[model samples]
Target: MLRTTVARLTVRGLLGSRRGLLLLVVPGLLLLMSVIARGSSADKQQLTATILGQLGLGTLVPLLGVVVGTGVISTEIDDGSIVYLLAKPLPRWQIITTKLIVAVLTSWVVAAVPTLLAGLVLYGTKDALAVGYAVGVLVASTAYSSVFLLLGVVTRNAVVAGLAYALIWESVVGNFVEGARTLSVQQWGLAVARAVAPHGGISTNVGLGAAVPLLVLVTVGAGWLAAVRLAGLTLAAGD
Candidate 1:
């Protein structure tokens, strides 16, 4: 069970700030584009795929991941307030787990919900496109939250690193390079989406066999490593 106090604190830190307003911007634009696309005579499948895949999964989810995931721990670490939390008797793993849950839930609310709404507006559940991409967004958001949270623990420049990975590596390189696609979280997510939708419009280079294990590894490994790192923070500061 999540400690209600830690979870509540994390939720407040995430939603009760200007960053929370910024998080809503992209999702709003996604919905607007969906509304506009709904009236157009363009192909619905192609539009849904492009909007949900490129904008929803590609841009919004990772950005939100960076914002929410990093914000959870990095801000406290930076402001020197994390010392208070560490000084308490709480298990290091519980703190990391609580924050991870917050980041994942925040990412889901901001990114996945909008993707689902956009998919519905653009395609109206046709070909299971909305549900497919929503599932993709959910999976991608979880992975993004895990990886970005690890970055937050390890680096002050977590947002920059996340952007470099998401935009530069995943968006630019993963598209042109075959090897890069195999290593991409986005592709892993698309693999899940492809399974759910099973439509040709939603393409994935990775298979479920590979994607599921990779997702599990990344999520569990990152959380475990983050807990280890946090456990040492007090000792490192004293030394």
Candidate 2:
């Protein structure tokens, strides 16, 4: 269901624009902070857990998700360029999937790579902390792309809506509300990290059994929804 033509245009729009700078800057900040943290006198394992788990996974991953995820398609819709995709004799699912593929792969490089590098800088490879959090960030990146892409497809204020959901609901509410943690992408990622590095001191409210299924469900479900919604958007635009 991948289309190179659509994927090429999506990459140009997402990375060849000013927003591409953000994709670099955010990850740059994480690396810088990690270097600074490495020089500190704090416990190495604790620092790794806090920085990689909380800052990298909880913050940077999701923020990049919103940026890359929504950016893939929202700008085209806003500038009335999405008609090009609709004009093609292609299925809407292929269109959404192609854009989502770009978002996920871009996010892995921009966000997940930094997590791995930062994890190493902060705590080395002891207990596989770097690889573990990097894997978690990878998973969260995919799920976030699908979800925020759906928001981009169905809403006019995709950036604003995505930021609100990520900052307010995912970060804040998901932290304070007990029931919210179960559904948090951040928490689910933490679960994966725990599994990857069982001795790495990673901790989260979710267990791997539930988190695995939830992650799969959200990623696949949101992508499917975006495809369905995209058809409606094409119809609405036509009329």
Candidate 3:
């Protein structure tokens, strides 16, 4: 369901916007924090967990998801230019999948590189923390991209809605409301990180049994939903 033309346009739109600046700025900030965290005399493994697990997987990935996902199509929808795209013979699902691919790749590049680098800086290759979180980021970015891309399709406030979901639901609620942790992308990613770093540098309430299914469900379900929504697109509705 991928289309080269749709993919090219989405990439150009994403890079030409302020979201491109964010793609650079967020990674720089992550690397800078890794430098600062490196000097800390705290327990290295635990510190690595906190930095990469809590901040990297929990915060940064989803934030970039919001920016990249929404950037791909929300601007077109908001400006009423999506009508031209819809007028084309391309299947709506193809459009959504192509944009979802762009969002996933963009979010992964900006979020995963710094995560791997920061893991190296803080706790170098031990327990494979660097690779683990990078893998975790890949999984989480795919799921988050699909969800936020759906948000972009269905709502004018996709960015704001995505931020609230990332911060409030994923971060705050997932922390305090222990039961809700099962529903979070952060927890799903942590499950992967926990498996990869089995030497105990990281921990998570979620396990592969729950996380794997949820990740697939969310990613596939959201992509399907976004396609369904886009198939019904009208200029007035898109805006």
- Most TM-score-accurate candidate: 2
- Model 3: lDDT to the true structure: 0.87
Q: How many clashes (backbone N, Cα, C below 3 Å) per candidate?
A: 0, 0, 0
Q: How do the residues 1-239 of candidate 2 rate in per-residue lDDT, one tens digit apiece?
A: 33888898889888898889999999999999999989999999999888887777877788889999899999988889888779888999989988999999999999889999999888888999899999999999999999999999989898899898888877787767878899999999989989999999888889999999999999999999999999998898889
Report the error of model 1 at residue 32, Å: 1.1
Whole-model lDDT per candidate: 0.85, 0.90, 0.87
Q: Is candidate 1 or candidate 2 better by TM-score?
A: 2
State how far residue 106 of model 3 sits from its true place (Å).
1.0
Scored by lDDT, model 1 comes in at: 0.85
Weakest 10 consecutive residues, lDDT, candidate 3?
A: 230-239
Q: Please provide, for model 3 over 180-238, each residue's C-alpha lDDT reduced to its tens digit, 9 standing for 90 to 100.
A: 99999988988987788788557778898899999999999999999999988854555
Candidate 3 global TM-score = 0.95
User: What is the lDDT, from 0 to 100, of the residue 146 in candidate 2?
Assistant: 96
TM-score of 1: 0.96
Greater-TM-score candidate between 2 and 3? 2
lDDT of 1 by residue, 111-161 (tens): 889998999999987788899889988988898898888998888898789
Assess candidate 2 and give its TM-score to the true structure. Answer: 0.97
